[model samples]
Target: MGMKDKFQDQAGQRQQQANDKTGESREKAGQRSSQQRERSSQQRDRARQDIDDTRDEMEDRFNQDYDA
Candidate 1:
């Protein structure tokens, strides 16, 4: 092949390699973001449940005091 054709081929190959790396990085970033969201959701649910339980316990104590 001529020098121009060879140069063009090399440039194409480099572009393809760079594109592949970018795609992989994007996929990994998406996965990490998804996992973080799931973990935050779980923590929020647990906190809500804890607050509800505390409220119920306090109500029970107040009722007992009134009965006495």
Candidate 2:
């Protein structure tokens, strides 16, 4: 192959490598974002459950006091 053709081939290979890396990075970032969202959702659910449990316990105590 001529020198010009060889140079173009090498440039094309480098461009392809860069594109592959970019795609992999984007996939990894998406996975991390999804995991973070899931964790936040779980935390909110737990907080709501805790609040409901506390409210029920307090109501039970108040009823007992009134009964006695």
Candidate 3:
């Protein structure tokens, strides 16, 4: 595959892995105490934000590469 396709594939894989980790974290946090649960919830939000940022960066890179 070309560099663009390779980058797209890697981005998709990273997104899927992030989603899986977030789901697992949420499931485990369900059994935590109130304070711990709150902490885990915050962690989940951070993870989501990280995923969004990565996705946006990947899209920007992909666009730049393809537009060239």
Candidate 4:
């Protein structure tokens, strides 16, 4: 091939490689974000559950003391 053609081919290959790397990086970032969101949701749910349990325990103690 001519020099010009060879140069063009190399440039095209480099562009494709860059595009592929960009795509992979984006995919990994998306996955990490999704995982973080899921963990946050779980933590919130657990905190709510703990609050409910504590409230119930306090109510039970008050009721028993009043009865006695």
Candidate 5:
């Protein structure tokens, strides 16, 4: 092949490699975002549970004082 043809072939190969890498990176980023969202959901659930527990405890304390 001529020199120009070889250079063109190499450029095409490089472009394909770059496209493949970009696709893989996008998939990885999506996975990480999903994981982060799951973590945030778990944290929110825990906070809600804590709030409920505190409210119940306060109600119990008030009842005890009222009874006494």
Candidate 6:
């Protein structure tokens, strides 16, 4: 092959490798974001449950005071 053709082939190979690496990095990033979202959702659920429990306790105390 000519010098120009050899250079073109090498450039194409390098481009393909760069593209593959980028795809892999993007996949890993997506997975990490999904995990973070799940963790945040779990935390929000726990916080809501705590608030509901506190409200129930407060209502009970208020009812007791009113009855007395």
The candidate that achieves the highest TM-score relative to the unseen native structure? 5
> In lDDT terms, how accurate is model 4?
1.00
lDDT (C-alpha, whole model) for all candidates = 1.00, 1.00, 0.94, 1.00, 1.00, 1.00
lDDT of 2 by residue, 1-68 (tens): 99999999999999999999999999999999999999999999999999999999999999999999
Off by over 4 Å in 5: none
lDDT of 2 at 17: 100
Clashing residue pairs in candidate 1 are none
Give a tens-digit lDDT track for model 4, residues 1-68.
99999999999999999999999999999999999999999999999999999999999999999999
Candidate 4 wrongly placed segments (more than 4 Å): none
Clashing pairs in 2: none
lDDT by residue for model 3 over 1-68, one digit each (tens)?
89999999999999999999999999777766677878999999999999999999999999999999
lDDT digits (tens) for residues 1-68 of candidate 5 = 99999999999999999999999999999999999999999999999999999999999999999999
Q: TM-scores of all models?
A: 0.83, 0.89, 0.51, 0.90, 0.93, 0.76
Candidate 2 similarity to native, TM-score: 0.89
> Which candidate, 1 or 4, would have the higher TM-score against the true structure?
4
Worst 10 residues of 4 by lDDT: 59-68
Question: After TM-score superposition, what is the CA distance of residue 59 in candidate 3 from its true location, in Å?
Answer: 0.4
lDDT at 58 for candidate 3?
Answer: 100
TM-score of 6: 0.76
Candidate 1: regions farther than 4 A off: none
- What CA RMSD would candidate 2 show? 1.0
Q: CA lDDT of 7 in candidate 1?
A: 100
Clashing pairs in 3: none
When 1 and 6 are scored with TM-score, the better candidate is 1
